[model samples]
Target: MAIYLVGDIQGCYDSLCVLLDMAAFNPQHDHLYVTGDLVARGPDSLATLRFMQELGEHGHTVLGNHDLHLLAVAKGIMRPKARDKIRAILDAPDREKLLQWLRHQPLLIHNETKNETASGFVITHAGIPPHWTVREAKQSARDVEAILHSDRYLWLLQNMYSDEPSMWSSSLEGIEYYRYTINAFTRMRFLTMSGNLDMACKLSPDKMSDENLVPWFAAKRRETIKETIIFGHWAALGGIFQNNFLGLDTGCVWGGSLTMVRWEDGQKFNLSCPV
Candidate 1:
């Protein structure tokens, strides 16, 4: 069975279906792993949520920033923005089920299969921070996931909105630790020269005017990482294919192409989308 990794659907259900058909994905055999942002900014979020939910174990996803936002809105911690385009999901009768599934999703997924290459891959919403090794990132993700899946999840959803504590520290505690972990896994894009998250900039590296800021992937990474890092969330990246990192968000909802990569062979499939 083939394993496929697709970029953010962002509620572009039609485009996602067409792209998956082109890939000849078989839910019975082939598994589909999403880079997250399963809903938002496009049409038919309800349908997208339903389709992915029905895929059951065959479809796996890590939580994206938008996904978290939806949960927050469901909990009345936040209001839905017009551009978010998620009202249908919030209004659906199965809203609780969909939100529960999304709420329980992890922030990181490590797929290091023994049958494949020794070093498999790790998928997160954006990318892993350079400060943490893969093991540290995984553990940090579990910490937040535990909260998200527990009674304190409402507290987390209520308090996870800050951009502070931009730098990571082992001594970080309480909300700082949870917020930092969430930001690093989902919202990270650029890092200041001092290796702190630059939460404001979303421009591609070439168009970046700040010379002091580097794309997270361009920063010096921890030397212990051996597995490939796969991520989405930066539509401006277009699609980055480097030595050990792959970015698949091609901005399908913004008139770019929906993109997916076959994990076993690294073959890519794309479908052009309209604005």
Candidate 2:
């Protein structure tokens, strides 16, 4: 039974299937863990969500920013952007079922099975904030996930769109807590010199014009983390593998290849996007 970790599909169903086939994934036995952004921006948001739903126990995904936005749009909290391409999902007969499943997904996945280089791995839509240890991240994610999976979820989806409280604080509560948790888990990329989230910068590290900003993984950590961090929100990274960190959003919707990594042996598979 192999375990595979895939980058953002973003509705590129054909590319995802091809990449999985190239890796010879057998859903009957092998598990497929996605780094989120399962739908949006590509041609088949409806089909992509359906496929992931069908995967059932074989598939797992964290929630991406786009996934959260889809929920908000479906709930009439916001209108979909013209470029979103998620109308199919909103119009689907099983839209409620699909979005419910997505909403119930967590902001982080942690596996404790030991590997040679690290204790295990944790997957998030974006890289973990440098200020939190793995245990702290797990608790933070659970706190947000509890709200996301509860009746107050609409409130969470509505209030989750802000960019304030750029840094973590123990005293933060209510909307500040939820917003910061969502941003750090889904939209984070760079950190300012003072270790606050630089939410406005989406450029890759080398392309970043601000010398004071560094990728979240590069920022000084609150403590040394022993687990590998896997994330996929930064397509500009073009797939990064360094030390214990792996960034796998290769921009399949933007003409780059879809990517997958076999968790046991660390072998990677890529299929060029035909979308």
Candidate 3:
């Protein structure tokens, strides 16, 4: 069975279907790995949420920033943002079920089988920090995953944001600490050359400050994950760059296109949206 790693859906339900058909996806046989941002921005978040809930029963979804935000809004912990189009999902009958499913989703996934030793995988919604080893990154993710998979998840989600140490810290406090940690994993884009996060800027690296700001992947990091990583959420990164990691969120909600990648070979495909 082939595994098709899909990019951000962002509530473009019709485009998702078209892309799936184009991939010849057979959920009964092949697995679907989604990079998250399952809902928001587009017109059909309720449809996206339901469809993802169904697909996730048989597939895998790495939680994106949008997915987490949806949960926050659903729980009344936060309000809607400028680009969010999740009203339908918030009003849906099965909203609770969908949020529960999203909470249970992971932040990272990998398959370091005997397949491509040079490049296996380590999937997250956004890119990983350069300083953290693959093991370090996975462990941080696991910490949040535990909270997500636990009964105390509601507590964590309510306080999941911060301006903390500004770098990875082993001894963190409150759920807010963990929130910042997860945020970087799922929403990070620009990084200083020193490896600190530049969270304010949303422009591509080219348009950012010339100081030390660079794409997260551009860091001359110590290579721990010696495999190809696939992620989304930074639409500014565009799709499929540097021939190592894959950024699949081509901003379909902003008139970009939905994207998909063949897991084993890395072939690419997309479907355009009107935004």
Q: What is the lDDT for 76 in model 3?
A: 83
Candidates sorted by TM-score, descending order? 1, 2, 3
**Candidate 3: 10-residue stretch with minimal lDDT:** 111-120
- The digit string of per-residue lDDT tens for model 2 on 100-183 reads 898999999998887574358899999899889998999999999999889999898888877899988999999898899999
Model 1 lDDT tens row, 1-275:
98999999999999989998999999999999999999989998899999999999999999999999999999899999879999899889999999998899999999987445335899999999988898899999999999999999999999999999999999999999999999999999999999999999999999989999999998997665778899999999999998889999999999999999998888999999998
Candidate 2 residue pairs in clash (backbone atoms < 3 Å):
none
Please name the candidate that would achieve the greatest lDDT relative to the true structure: 1
Lowest lDDT 10-mer window, candidate 2? 111-120
User: Any idea what lDDT model 3 has?
Assistant: 0.80
| Candidate 3 error regions (>4 Å) | 114-119
- Candidate with more favorable, higher TM-score: 1 or 3: 1
Positional deviation of residue 209's Cα in model 1 after best superposition, in angstroms: 1.9
lDDT of 3 by residue, 1-275 (tens): 77788888889989988998998888888888889888888889788778767864567889888888888888788899987899887787887888887788889987675465235677899878877788888888898899889888878877776545566566666675587678778878877777777778888777776776878887777765576778898887678655677788888888989888877676677888885
Q: Candidate 2 lDDT (Cα, whole model)? A: 0.90
Report the poorest 10 consecutive residues by lDDT, candidate 1: 112-121
lDDT, residue 187, candidate 1 = 98
| TM-score, cand. 3 | 0.92
Angstrom error at residue 225, model 1 = 1.6
Candidate 1 has which clashing residue pairs, if any?
A: none
